[model samples]
Every structure is written in C-alpha cells, then in structure tokens.
Target: MNSNSDVTSRTVTALGPQLRRRKSIKHMVGEAESNSGQLRRTLGMWQLTMISVGATMGTGILVILGAAVPIAGPAIWISFVIAGVTALLSAVSYAEMAGMVPVSGSSYSYSYATMGEGIAWICGWCLVLEYAVSVAAVAVGAGEYVNQTLRTFNMELPVSLAGGPAEGGVVNLPALIVVVLATLLLVRGARESAIVNTVVVIIKAGILVFFSIVAFSAFNAGNFEPLLPMGAAGVTAAASSVFFSYIGFDAASTAGEEAKNPKRDLPRAIMLSMLIVTITYVLVAVSAIGAREWTWFVGTEAALVQIVGELTGQPIFVLIFALASVLAIASVVLTVLYGQTRILMSMSRDGLVPAVFGKVSKRTGTPVAGTLITGIVVAITAGFIPLGALADATSIGTLFAFALVGVSVMYLRKRQPQAPRTFRVPLYPITPILGIFACLFLMSQLGWHTWVVFLIWMLVGIVIYLGYGRRRSRLGQLSKQDYIASHVGENQ
Candidate 1:
C-alpha cells in the first residue's frame, strides 16, 4: 500500500485503542487551561449567554418571518415553539458534553475523545459549513436591510453595489463590509467581542420588545381567525425553516476553553440563551400577526417596516426598525464568525488542518490568522452567493453536528462509566436519542437539493482526510505509543 492508504487504514484503529488511547477526563480539564499562551478563560455566564443570544436572535426572525408567515399563517407562533423544543434536546446533550470535555472544538473535540479521529474530523467539517455559511447568509440579509434603510432616507445605492449577480448586482459591497468589520472585532480579542455582543444583544432585544408593544396596540383578534390556514404540514415545514435561528446556542459551547467556569456556567448559558430567544421570538410572531393581516407579510423583506408604516403612517419608526435590523444582523455575523475561527483553530491543533490556523496571538489572546482567513472566505461567499439555498445548508449542517454531539454523550456514558462529569444529560439515553431523531426529522423536511449539497460537502471532507489530514494527525503519534503499549502488555 502507498503511504496515504496505510495512514487511512490505520485511522479507524485510532478509535479501537480506547483502553490505551482514550484521553482521560482529567487530561482534558487541565489542557483547557494549562497552555499559558492559549485562549484565556475570561467569559462568565453573562458574556457567554450574550454570545449565544446575540448570535441566535438575528436574521432568522427578521428575514425568515417574511417567507414563513405565508405558509403557516397566524399559527407561525407554534412553529417557533416547535423549533425551540427541537433545539432544547441537542442543547441538553451539549451541556453534558461541554461540561465533560471543556475544550474549544465543541462537538468535534467531544467526538475525538469519545468516538475517534475520523468522526471528529467530519463533525468539525460540518461545523465549518454551519458557521461559515451562516455568516454569509446573515450578511446578505444585513446588506438588504442596510440598503432599505438608506433608501428610506432618499439615499439610493446602485444595484451593483447592493446585491449579488443573482439580484442583478456586480458585487454585494455592504455584505462584504459587515464581514470585514466583524472580522476586525474578532481579531481584537474574545472578551472585547463578548462585550460588544452584550451591548448589541441588549439593543436588539429592546428594539424587538418595543416593536412588539407597538404591534399589540393595533391588535385585531380577527387577524388570528384562520390560525392554521395551511394545516399541520405547513406548521411542520415552517418549524424546520425557522430552526436556523436556534443554531447559535451551541456556539456558546465552542467557547469552552475561554469560559471562567465551563462546567457549571456553560450549561447555564446554553439554557438561558435558548429561553430568552424563544420567548422573544414568540412575542414577536404573535404581535406581528396581530398588528396586521398575515397576507401582508408574504414575500416582503422588510415586514417590520411595512407593519410599522401601516400602523402610524410614520417613516421615522420604520427607519428605526430598519436600522435595528441592520445592527442585529451585524452582531449575528460577528458571533458566528467568531465560532467558525475557533473551531478551525481547535481542529488545527489536532493536526486535522494546517498548524498556521492554530497560531495564537499573545498580544490579543486570539487566533488572528484563522480569523482573517475565515473573514476573507466568508466575505467572498457573501458577496456572490444568493441567500435562499445557502440558508438551508446552514441549518442542515448544524443539525448533523448536533446529532453527532448527542450520540457522543451516549457513547461516553457507556465507555467511561466512571469518568468524572460535572453535568450529565438527564433521562440517560432517551435525551440523546430524541436529540438525534429530532435532527433527522427536521432534516427530512428540507428539500432534496439541500441533501445533495450536504452530501457533496461530506465527500469533500472525506477526500481531505484521506489525502492530507490522515498522515498528519497528532492523534496518530499518540496512537502508535498506545499500540506498542498494548503489545507490551500482551507479551507480559
């Protein structure tokens, strides 16, 4: 066999050395903090929750609502609840794994120590798709809102600078600009980014709350007459579509290495962020339909503006809502981009990618190189790709990653029955099994085109693993030592 084939064949064996090759719980705990030049543990529960909150509460509500209300009618509020419940299953699994592993790779690192190197690579690859594409998708929506706000002031930008070729534009300048700004903020430092995120989250939440109050004042009970206009199927489809908003609660777990008290605080942050986001979404959905007819929301990108304009005949409120949407989308881009870079850094540390990505800047305590690389790639993608299909890809990628983390929690419980765990998934295997199935059910609701794209992405990941990552893995070196130790035990 050639050297590459030799490496690929043995990569599966990396999982078999559970007795000798498994990373001990204690080792992972120390590694989370002992590397003096590594990511600093500076985030507490509040900052970490804001990262998840700021990331989760963006374009999903502002953009997806326009597309979803036409299908689910006034019953769209039920869709939000369904999506939130689905997220909660995987989230509990995340809490358990984050508390146990306490590392930067999120699901990827948890899979490494429990499942094996190959699964870890695939999990990490899925996360890259999730975060990077999510950033691109959010940027596109942010650009649209920014342009709309400008037009409201009688300041029109050229079509070429405002959108992609799909929208008859040469390039998406506004989308590219937001990506660059978020990247610069990320490179500054994690704590600084967290602080900015907290401020943004407060402002975004306040705007939504104010919008809800205004919407409810003009409430007409008659608007909700035909709640499930399209029936249960429509609600299910809308739930699957709206699930994109909840993807970022898991981003909190990616900051495991930078959390002050990861074990207790990580779980708290995940649950708290989810609760806050779910409540906010439900209020907005109800108030929106109550404010006007559901037909008014269909095919409209600026539903908030349209609703406010109709309510008060005032351009000022419409502009305020438009500006808030712009800022909210920008914050989502920042948080998810931060997540993508961190995941790449963790994978790089395992020799699954180039070591350059793993480089930490001592002055900033951040992965500057990875952050810049992710920024450029996402900027290009945002500047060109249309948002429709890419958004589905982000949701599918996240569901896949969540399913893997859910399974990893179950596998670890069986393999390391005595491992020290500060937190554990409630109801044992039921929680993870539900999490996995819930993700699969939602994945089934997406169109066939999304599955085709997801499969192609997975194939590319497999090729990279065989061609480059297999031979270079740091885990291989450790596995060899364990292999020799196993033989030595046999001889003894």
Candidate 2:
C-alpha cells in the first residue's frame, strides 16, 4: 500500500503542470491588451464595415459565379441565400463573442478562453489555411482579370507570362505583383489598409451596381426555364462553394482589437457587412443569369465582364468591369492577408507558433515579420500552383472554423454565464446549434479529396503542437493568477 501510494503521488506531481494549464478568458484578454504590443485602435464602425464588405465581395462573386452557376443554373441565387444564412448564423455568434472579448485572435482566442489550448491551436491552424490560401486563390483570380483588362487595351501578355502552367502560364507574375502590393499595404499599417479598402469598396460597389442595371435591361425570362437544372444536390454542392463569399464577414471580428469601439462596432459591423454582401450577391446572381443563360457563364475567364460585353458590345464596359474585378480582388487579398497575420500574431503571443510572428513593429503597429512570411507563401502559391480545387479546400477550412466558433459561443455561455457580454446571440442555443449544423452539412458536400487534405493538414498541426507549442505555450508558462496579477501590476 505504501509503495503504491508513493508511485501515485509521484505521477500526480509529475502531471501537475500539464493538468493545471488553463487559458482563462480574463487572462487571454489581458494578454492581448498588455503583452501583445497591440495594434492601434483607429478603425471606426464604417471603416470596419468596409473591411468586411471588401473582404467578402471579391473573388467568390467575381470568379466563382462563373464556375458555380452551371451547377445550379439560375437557382444559384438560392444557394447564395443558403450560404448567406449559414454565415449569418455564425456571424451572430461571432458578434457576441467579439463584443465580449474584443481581442485580436478572433475565433482562435475565443476558443482558447472557452475551450482549451488544444482546441484553440486547431482553430488557429484552420484559420491560417483559410486566410492564407484564400488570399492566394483571390490573387490568382485578380491576376487573370487584370490580364483580361489589359487585353481590352490590346496589351495582352503571353499565356506563359500570365499564370501558372496549369492555367497555361509559366510564372503568374501579375498575381505575385498583387500579393506583394497587398503585403506592403499591410506592413505599413491597418489604418492605411482600411483606407485603401474603403476606396476600393466604393469603386467596386459602383461598378457592380451599374452592371446590374444594364444586365436587368437585357433580362430574359427564358433563362428561368429550369432553375434546378442539376437538381437539389447540385444546389447544395454549389452552396458549399458560394459559401466562400460569405467567409469574409468574420474578418471584421478579427479586427476587434483595432476597433475604436469593439464592443459596439464589432457586432454591428459583422451583421451589417454580411447584410450588404448578401444583397449584393443576390443582385449580381439574378442579373448574371437573367441577362444570359447560365451555360454561357461556365468556364469563362471573366464572367461578369463577358456578360456586360455581350450585352452592350462595348469594350469600355468590359474595361470597367475588368478594373472593378482587379480592385475588388485586391481588397479581398488585403483584408484576408491582414486577418491572417493578426491570427498568427495572436498565436505567437500565446507561444503556439514562432515568436517571430508575435513581434509587432512599433512604427507600424503591425506584425511585419509574420506579414512578410505570409505574403511570400501566398505569392508562391498564387504564382506556381494552379487553383484547381483549392477554393473548395479553403471553403472546407473556413466552415470548420465557423463551426468551432459557434461551439465556442455556446461553450462560453454555459461556462461563464456571469461574464460581461455587450451582445448576445439570438435564440440562445438554437442559433449556435444551427450555425454548427449548417457548417457541417455544407462541409459534407465537399469532395473526399478536400477532406483528405484537411485531415492531413490537421494532423500536421497536432504534430507541431505536441513537438513545440504544447510545452512552450505562454499559458503553460504562467499560472492564471500570475498572468492577471502581472497585468494588474502593469496598470498600477
């Protein structure tokens, strides 16, 4: 009995540090405010809303519509609603969390505080894939559209100089150029990026509206003959793709720390931006299909520009549409790239990734190192890899992140009922539960190859966590009270 007791005590003592590791809500928030070398809180509600709009309305609307329309015919509009609703549900939960926490990591920090370090790491990992790869994907789309715009001027580059080999281009220099430009914008500061994003958003919105009016003039009811040409399965499958457009509303929440009034503005920006984007998407979808048969859009390089060109036979309109696409896609890349570095900065602050990612430049108040690293990786992916099915892969990663965020909201509600909340998710558990189910349903519609890749990526995250992050986690290094006390001491 004595021998057994001794062994048990030894084991318990050995496991104490690991077992006691806790990333509490308060500690996480304090770490963000005091220790992260925080970002400047310069963004107003409108600027924040524009970030969401700019990020959400880009490549998916401009490019994916060409690919998604044939799958659901004219009924691709319904898929937009379905995807939009799912995104809104998740956004509601995100709004509540963003209001209450108002931190930089977005869902990753929420998960860390509500769940545990392990789940938080996974969430952060998923976001890295979602933001970085989505940026790369959008960059490629932007490059293609820029090339199209140049062609209108009869200044077309060789296919070899335009894109990767898969897209029949050797290097995709234009895509690389846009990524580098976006990187420079981000490294300068978030406020400057937001200013540029706002201007881009206005220009893109104006062009989209103009095209919609023209498209409606040429609208033919014949395009509606068979709305569900590919059936319900096809609509749902396309919803899984269209869901990409909805992904960026959450980018607003990622800027919680930088919001001048996060508790008030973050939630408002989230819901408002999503509303604007949903309306814009519906108008564009209706106009595109009504103006031309859905079949006409399939496989087209610049579908919207082609629609406008076909409608008016005007090279000027094609030029305008092409310019809008380039601006819109560049803004998406900027916003998402900004969001990516912030997540990585948060992860680095928590010691889940390299310390270099955590370092914020005093002059710019930005994560310069992480921004450069992300920019280089995104540029390479856009320059070399053909984005065949990667958009679907990115959609899956985003859905997984959304599901976890919904789960985090519910978890926090139950675990910290007394925690101060500036906003609450509507309908309690139903909203969050629906958000989770919707994400899972959409995720199920993704192809098996996407799932395999996602699994492999997650497995790699686990290996990295175990090897480096698990022991090195900042939360592991400090006791909960110690962290709180340190912050209190600093304030005093």
Candidate 3:
C-alpha cells in the first residue's frame, strides 16, 4: 500500500505541469494589454463591423459562383445559405468567446484559455493557413478583375505580365499590385486601414446592389427550374466549397485588443457583420442565378461582371463593376492580412513564434515587421500559385479552426460557468453543437487532396511546436505558485 501511494504521487507530480499548462484567461488578456505587446485601441463598433464585413464579403462572392455553379447548378443560392448558417453559428460562438477572453488571438486564445497549449497551437496553425493562403486567393481574384477593368480601356497588360504561371504567364503582376495596395494601407495603421476599408466596402456594396437590380430586370425564372438539378448531395458539396465565401466573419474577433470596448463591441461587431454578410450573400447568389443559366457560369471569369455586362450591354457598367470588384477584393486582402499579423503577434507574445512577429511599432502602433514580412510572402504566393489549388486548401483550414472554436466555447462554459460574457450564444449547447457538426460535415465534403494538404500542414505545425515552441513557451516557464496566482478566478 505504501509503495503504491508513493508511485501514484510521483506519477501525479510528473503530470502536474502538463495539467497547468493552459494559459489562464486573465494572464492572456493582461499580456495583450501589457506595454510591450499592446496595440492601439482606435476601433469602435462600426469600424470593427466593417472589418468583419470587408473581410467576409469580398473574396468568395466575387469568384466562387464560377466554380460552385457547375457543382450545384441553380440551387447555388441554397449553398450560400448553408455556408452562411454554418458561419453564423460559429460567429455566435466567437462572439461569446470574444466577450469573455477579448484578445487578439481570436480562436487560438479561446482554445488556450479553455483547452490547453496543444490545442491552442493547432488552432493557431490553422489560422496561419487560413489567413495567409486566403490573402493569396483573394488577390488572384482581384487581379483578374483588374484585368477586366483594363480591357474596358483597351490597356490590359500583355498575357505574360497579367496571368499566373498556371495561366501560362511569367508572373501575375496584377495580383502583386493589389497585395501591395493593401500592404501599404495595413503598415500605416489599423485606424487608416479601417477607414479605407469602410469606404471601399460601401462602394462595393453599392455596386452589388446595382448588379442585383439589373439582374432582376433580366430575371429568368426558367434558370432556377432545375433548382435541385444535382440533388441535395450536390448542394452540400458545393456548400463545403462555397463556405470559403463566409470565412471572414471572425475578422471582428481578431480586432479584440484593438477595439475601444472589446468586451462589448467585439460581440456586437461579430454578430452584426455576420448578419450583413449572410443577407448580402443570399441576395447576390439569388440575383446572379436569376439573370443567367447556371451552365454559362462554368469557366467564366468575373461571373458578376459578365452578368451585368450581358444584361446591360454597356461598356461603362462593366468598367464600374470591374473597378468595384478590385476594391472589394483588396479590402478582403487588407482585413485578412491584418487578422493574420495579429494572430502571430498574440502567438509570439506567448513565445510560440519569433519575437519579431510580436513587435509593435511605437509610431504606427501596428506590427510593422510582421506586416512587411507577411506582405512580401503573400505577394509572392499570389504572383505564382494558381488560385484553383489555393481555394479548397483555405476552406479546409478555416473549417478545422472554426470547429475547434465551437468546442472551445462548450469547454469554457462548463469550466468557467461564472465568467462574465457580454454576449451569450443563443440556445446554448445546441447552436455550438450544430456549428461543430456543420463544420465537420462540410469538411467531410472537401476533396481528398485538400485533406492531404491540411494533414501535411498540421504535421509541420506539430514538428515546429515540439522542436521549438514547447521549450520557449512563456506559459510553460511559469512557476507553479505563480501559475496558480495568475489563474485566480478562472477555474471557479
């Protein structure tokens, strides 16, 4: 009996540190506000809402129909609803987490405070893939639309300079152009970036409204006749793919630290932005299909512009539509690129990544070094890689992260029942459970190649965490006494 108790004591001691390894919610929020890691809190609810709207509304709407229409035919509107609802459920969970945690790490921070370091690292890794590759994907779409605009003036770049290597061009110089425009805005500061994004968002939203009006005039109810042409399975599969269109609703959560009233505004921003994005997506998808045959959408570039152009037969309208798309897509690159840097900054603060990524400039109050590095990297990606291979990869990564966020919400609600939250997920467990199920089902619909790529990326993240992050972790280095003190009321 003595020997068994001693053996059990030793085992417990060995596992103690691992058990206490999760970063306390207090410590994580404090670290965000610390002088060394602080970001300027200039954003109000409107700016935060715009960031989410700008990020979520642009990339997928501009390009996804061309790819998704063939898969689901006229029923693509249902796919949009499926994707939007999946995103809405997760967005609600993110809102609850944002109010309770209120940090720049978004889902990563939520995972850390609720789950543990291992889970948090996995979430962060998916975020890196989600944001960076998405920037590239959005930029590629912007480049093509920019090309459309140039053609109206008969000044389009030669094919060698205009297209990605996949399209037989040496480099997609126009993609690089849009990335640079966004990079310049971001490096300046979040306030200015938000201002410009708000302006561009309004312009693009107007252009979309105009497109809807014109499309309705040419509405062909016949186009929607075979609404379930491909059946329910097809709608679900296309929902899995088109879910990429709803990826940016959590952009507001990433701005938690930068919000003037993070606990109050973050939740509001997330919910409001999600509402706007869902309505816009459904409206646009319905309008587009009503105006044209689903068959014509396949292989068409700038699907919306084509619809408006064919409907109106006006060169000036095509020019206007193309310009708005360029702005819209650039805003997405800007907001997502902003979210990407902030995630790394939070991770670096926890000593998971390089310190350079965590550094905030005194003048601009943004992560200057991180912004520049991210810009250069994403620019190169947009310049070279074809957009087709990039799209599914982003959706898979995002879905994985979102499912974990839903899990995090459930974990926290049970673990810290007393924690204050400005916003609570409606219907509690059911919403989150549905969110998790929705994400998993959508993820199941993804192509096997996307799964392979995602698995490889996760493998790389594991290697990095084991080899470097585990040793350098700020949380791991904390003394047990200090850790307990830091935890304070989190466990209660």
Q: Which candidate is the best by lDDT?
A: 3
Summarize candidate 2's per-residue lDDT along 1-492 as a digit string, tens digits.
255653443344323454334466666666657843558889999999998898898888888888899898889999999999999999999999998888889898887766667778888889988898888888887667877899898998788878898976798888888999999999999999999999999999898898899999999989977989899998999999899888778888888778889889999999999899999999999988899988887778678888788888989989888988888888999999989988888889877899999888899998899999989999999899876666568888889989988988887787677778888998989999999999999999999998988898899988998788876665665544564564452221
Highest TM-score against the true fold, candidate: 3
lDDT string, candidate 1, 398-456, tens digits: 99989998988888888777766777888988889998999999999988988888998
Q: Note the Cα lDDT for every prediction shown.
A: 0.84, 0.84, 0.87
TM-score of each: 0.93, 0.93, 0.95
The C-alpha local distance difference test score for the whole of candidate 1 amounts to 0.84
TM-score of candidate 2 on Cα atoms, chains taken together? 0.93
**Candidate 3 colliding pairs:** none
Model 1: CA > 4 A from native: 1-25, 483-492
Scored against the true structure, residue 58 in model 2 reaches a CA lDDT of 85
Q: Model 3, range 203-300, lDDT digits (tens) per residue?
A: 98898889889989988899998789899999999999899999888988888888999999999999999898889888998999998999988898
Per-residue lDDT value at 410 in model 3: 94
